[model samples]
Structures are given as C-alpha cells and as structure tokens.
Target: MKGVMRFGKKGKLSPRFIGPFDILERMGTLAYRVAFPSNLTEFHNVFHLSMMQKYMSNPSHVLNYEPLQLTPHLSFEEKPTQIRDMQEKRLRNKVIQMVKVKCMNHSKEEATWETATEMRSRYPELFGTF
Candidate 1:
C-alpha cells in the first residue's frame, strides 16, 4: 500500500513526527478537565492540518500557556517583575529560534547501534551480555 503526503512549493514537507498530534491531544484533555469536573473522557481533538501549521509557525508563543496569578489587590513592584519576565521569555524565544535553524540544517540521526556500543563500553553492566 502507498501513502500520500502533502508538500509545499519549495519542497518543504509536513512534519513527519506526531508531535503536533500529541500536543493537541494534551490540550483537549486539559479542556475537558476544565469543562467537566468529573468522569472526564480520554478522547481529545488532536491537531490537524490548520491547527498544527499554526502552532509550528509560532511554537514558542502557542506552546507557552502558563497562567499568571495575581491577587485582587496588586502591588506596584509586581508589574515590573512581570515585564522583566516577559522580556526574558522573548530572549529565550530568540535563542530557541537560532538553535532550531542550526538543528534543521542537520538532517541526520546518529546510528543507534553506534550509540549503544559506546554506552556499553561506558557502562558495561547495563548493556552486558547474559
């Protein structure tokens, strides 16, 4: 049997990994947990074409959904801390983007057996023969 794959004009292909699907699955679970307090279902709406594409385009922002908790009463010093946190986040995003570009350029997975052999030598007990 043959499988069909979609490709962009410049030969860019959709992600081969199921990472997007896993993300959507987790998000759907969270949504269900929030909506229904009890007897939650495991089935969740996973990321498809559009949703996955949107997230891949802006992964840093889309993935970071941590809620900020603030008391009904706000202190003046708290605002600056939040601003600093936001700036640090932006800087971290920039660093991630730079590293991603480097990683994308290398389309290779090191040989699994080679790694295992090296591990065996390092920790003989773990990969020892029976």
Candidate 2:
C-alpha cells in the first residue's frame, strides 16, 4: 500500500479498508494481536491500535470473489465497464462535460464522475464514434 493506489483511472481514488479481522488479545496498552488467516501468516499478527479498526458485525457481507490479479508490484488497471450518466459541471467561467462512470470491480454506488472527453478517449467503445 505504498503511495496512493492509482487504479490508472487517472483519478484520485481513495485507498480501501481491507478487513475487520478478529482481535486475539491485547499486547499492551497500545497494541493488540490479531488472528491472521494462513494466507496472511507472512505479516506480523500484532498491530498498534491506530492501525486497526473495531470489528462490527455486518449481515450484507456474504458475496465472495477471487483475489484481484495484480502485477509483481501489486497493482491493477481500473477499466470503466459502463457509462452510467452524463452532466455538465459548472465552474467559475467554465463548464466541463462529465460522465458518471461505473468501473469494473465496483458497485453502482461506487461509480465515479470523470470528464467525458477523458472517458471517450480512454474507452472509445463506451462512446462509439464521437
């Protein structure tokens, strides 16, 4: 997770919060040991409280998917799957056309706003001819 995770969307997408892992025991006043699954055994189990979040039981977390394909450096390209909407963004002395883009690996609620020209250029199929 070094540097900002650029999905290559050319946008400043925020970093993702990965887990709500089980806290096994308190290591000290500021740290706790967490239960790590076999796949994450390479990482240290103890972490500072500042680096962890409290686990809240959630019922909507049922679906599972395969791990994302990443390069040896651990990054992936974010491709727009569909253009959901379009509108004009008004700025002082200017108006910019924008597209509501639904990207792969994200839900409808996570769709983002991107410049229409950029989207059309990067994903011509979404725009067809012009």
Among the numbered candidates, top TM-score falls to 2
Tens digit of per-residue lDDT, candidate 1, span 9-89 = 122222233222223224443231122212223323433344343344654555422222223331111111100011111
User: 2-83 in candidate 2: lDDT tens per residue?
Assistant: 2225333344443254445778899899999998665555557898888776656689866444344445553556667888
Candidate whose lDDT is highest: 2
Number of clashes recorded per candidate: 0, 0
What would the TM-scores of all predictions be? 0.14, 0.60
lDDT of 1 at 102: 11
In model 1, residue pairs whose N, Cα or C atoms come closer than 3 Å (at least 3 residues apart or on different chains), thus clashing, are: none
**Model 2: how far is 17 from its true place, Å?**
1.7
Model 2 residue 73 distance off true place after TM-score fit, in angstroms: 2.1
How accurate locally is residue 99 in candidate 1, as Cα lDDT from 0 to 100? 10
Please report how far candidate 1 places residue 53 from its true position, in Å: 12
Cα-based RMSD of the predictions, in order?
20.8, 5.1
Q: What lDDT would each prediction earn against the true structure?
A: 0.25, 0.68
Least lDDT summed over 10 consecutive residues: which range in candidate 1? 78-87
